[model samples]
Each structure stands twice: as C-alpha cells, then as structure tokens.
Target chain A: MLVNRVKELRAKYNLTQGELAKKIGVTRQTIVSLEKGSYTPSLLLAMNIAEVFNEPIEKIFIKREEEE
Target chain B: MRLYITVILRTLLYISLAIMVYDFVRIEQQFELLGRGYIDSFSVNVGNQVGQVFIVITIILVIMNVFQLFVMKRNKRAKVEDYILPEYDASDERSVEITGKAVRFAFVFILLYSFLILGSYMFVPNYFLDFVWYPMFTTASIPIIGLIVYLISFKIIYSR
Candidate 1:
C-alpha cells in the first residue's frame, strides 16, 4: 500500500537512474526498483530522495488507495 | 580499492609463508646437527628470524580480517536504505539458499584442510602447516557461520 513518484520526479530533474544514484551514493538499480514500486525505500532513503527532488515527502510518496 | 587491499594482504601472506619455510628448513638442519652433538649458532639466528616473521604475519592477517569485517558491515548498511528488490521473486530465495550451500561446502573444505595438515604433522612433515591453518579456518568460518545464521533467520521469517 505504498506508491512512489519516482518517474515523475526523475523526469522533472532530467536525470537518469545512474545519475541520480551517483548523486545519492547508491546503485542505479536502486532507482529502477523505486520506479517499479516493488521495493520500499527506508525512511532515510525516502527523505534523501525527497530532498534531492526538492519536493515534500508527501508529494514524492503517497500511501496506496487501500491504506488511505 | 578492495582489489588493491587484497593484493597487499596476499603479498604479506606470501612473504610470511616464505620466511616460515626458510626457518623450518633451518630447524631441520639444526636438529640433525644437534643429534650429532654439535650446536649451530646460525640455526639459532634463523629460528629467531622465523618467529619474528610469524608475528608480523599474524599482525597483518588480524588487520586484514578487521578490514574485511568493516567492508562487510558497510555493505550491509548500504543495502538497508539504498536499494530494493525488484520483486519478491522465488529466485531471490533460491539465490540465498544456493549461496548458503556454497558457504557450507567451503566450511567442509576447511575442515578437510585442517585434518589433512594435522595428519601430515603427526606422520609426514610439519612445514607450511602453520602458515595455512590460521587463515583457512578464520576467514572461512566467518562467512560460513554468517550465512548459516542468515539462512536460519530467513527460514523462520518466511515459513509463516
């Protein structure tokens, strides 16, 4: 019951997954999985990613419909 | 960086092993001389040198082991928040299990190596055995035990 705005945020920044990962000191695959939504980012990672995109945490990640 | 570190460590190990071999040959020759009722001064110097080499090697290996532990701990931390599994796929489970078994197999090899060296010491020759056993047992056991512990935890968590 978690949704992520990974694609939207990446597009807004005009960054590839590898570029984002390099900026954040993580692997490119991490960005791919974030977009796929199969993997959940930890609180720390979510905060970092949100900060990188210059968006509110709530804007970057929303609870799924059922959870709401 | 890891590669460079490993190379440096391996060089240290080799140098220590070579010194150990040199000492062992000296000891054997000195023992033969003592059997003939002659004391060899040069052999005593070689023996002391051998001990020094052993101490140096022990220190190097201990440092290297600590370095490996730090690297592994960092890797685990990075995995925590840095990435996600693409799917809750069966393959992930299988990969974990297969790697677990591989680790267990490596343990068995260590046990075999120890037994073989012990047997050789008691029967054939004692040279080079000391150089081999400490690193073999310590390095192999850490991952073997860690993987086994991880596998047990996974079984408990996922069984439900």
Candidate 2:
C-alpha cells in the first residue's frame, strides 16, 4: 500500500482541503480520499501535490512496506 | 450531493423519454386492436400529456447546460455552477477510476439482465396481446436500472 503524508503536510501549511485541491488541480473530495488513504493518486497529481507543498514526492508519499 | 442530483435529473430525463415511448406504443396497440388507421381523443390526450412532461425535462436540462456554459464563460472558477458537472464527473483521477468501476459493474448487470429479459419472453408467449407494456417498459427500464445501479455503486465507492 502507498502511504502519504498529505494530511500532515497540508496541516503544516495551514491549507484547507479545498485550497490544496485547487492548487493541485483536483476536486476537494480527491484530497479527502487521499488523506484517508482510500485513494492512490496518479504520478501527475503526486507531482502537483509535491509542487504545492514545495517538497519532493518521496518526502510526501512512501510505500508502506518501505516504512516497515 | 451535486453528482446525485445530476444523476437524478438524467434519470428523470430518461423516464420522460420512456413515457413518450410508452405513449407511442400504447397508441400502436390500440390501432392493432381496433383495426383502425386513426388516432382517438384519448390517445391524443395521452400523447399531449407525455409531450408536456418530455418538454419540461428537456427545458430543465437545457437550462442547466446553458447556465454552466455561461458560468464557464464569465469566470473560470465560479463554483456556483459546480452542480453542473460533466456527464460522469471525471473531475479527478480518483473519480475517473471510481466511475470506471461503476461502468464495469453496470455493464455486467446489463449483460445478465438482458438474458433474463429475453428469458422472460419464454414465459409470456403472448406478451403482444396480454402485456403490451412489458417489452416497452422493460426495454426502457434497462438503461434506467443500469443508471440506478451505477449511481448506487458510485456513491458506495465514493463514500469508501
């Protein structure tokens, strides 16, 4: 499974789900699903999210097995 | 949800179409039974009623579409028209995948339902004479049922 720190980073940046979604060109519900770990985003979306957070993709998204 | 409302409006549009079709078939059946080449007052009244319903639905859908277009033209990010979503939402990667799964589920349901509908004709050998609405309604119900099932599946998956 892919685990992401989207929620943590978004909180750190003080951005609402809708704001983050708009910056990343996605619907707010997609952000909600991503935070809940029920949806895995595509590479393009991951890149956009990384740009919005000003972080590398690896720092935001990681494989669960790798963490283990 | 806006998505659900759109789906409901679309379903109503479909129902209006089915009603119009039902009115047409009923008139045809009347002609067959009476062996006449003319339409009667009751049939015309039924046709007019169905026409009115069809026109109402068409107007609603058209108004929504035009409003969406106007919103897009005025402001690219005016979310007041958010309810005017595209046919399948496809708003993001997650929704695209979910919509795809819903379509697949609907496809499988339609395939099986088609066979069942065909098999039902075996039991009703005289459907033409006895149950005139059976074929008309069932044919129309295929897409209606598929849309309902798709909507249900999409909602369940989206909530998950």
Give the best candidate by lDDT.
Answer: 2
Tell me each candidate's i-RMS in Å. Answer: 9.6, 1.0
Model 1 stretches with alpha carbons more than 4 Å out: A1-8, A17-19, A22-41, A56-68, B4-8, B11-15, B18-22, B25-29, B36-160
Kindly list the per-residue Cα lDDT of model 1 for residues B1-160, writing each as its tens digit. Answer: 3323443444455555655766566567667777877764543654466467668766866776565545545554433211121111122222333334444554665566556655554552444434434443444444444434434443443332
Q: Which ten residues in a row have the lowest lDDT in candidate 1 chain B?
A: B80-89
Candidate 1: CAPRI quality band: incorrect
Give per-model TM-scores.
Answer: 0.38, 0.81
Model 1 lDDT tens row, A1-68: 78999898899889998898777656565676678875567787788888899899899899977744
DockQ of candidate 2 is 0.71
Q: After superposition, how far is residue B3 of candidate 1 from its true place, in Å?
A: 3.6
CAPRI level of candidate 2: medium
Give chain B TM-scores in order.
0.35, 0.75
- Distance (Å) between predicted and true CA of B1, model 1? 4.6
Could you report the DockQ of all the candidates, in the order they appear? Answer: 0.06, 0.71
**Which candidate number has the best TM-score?**
2
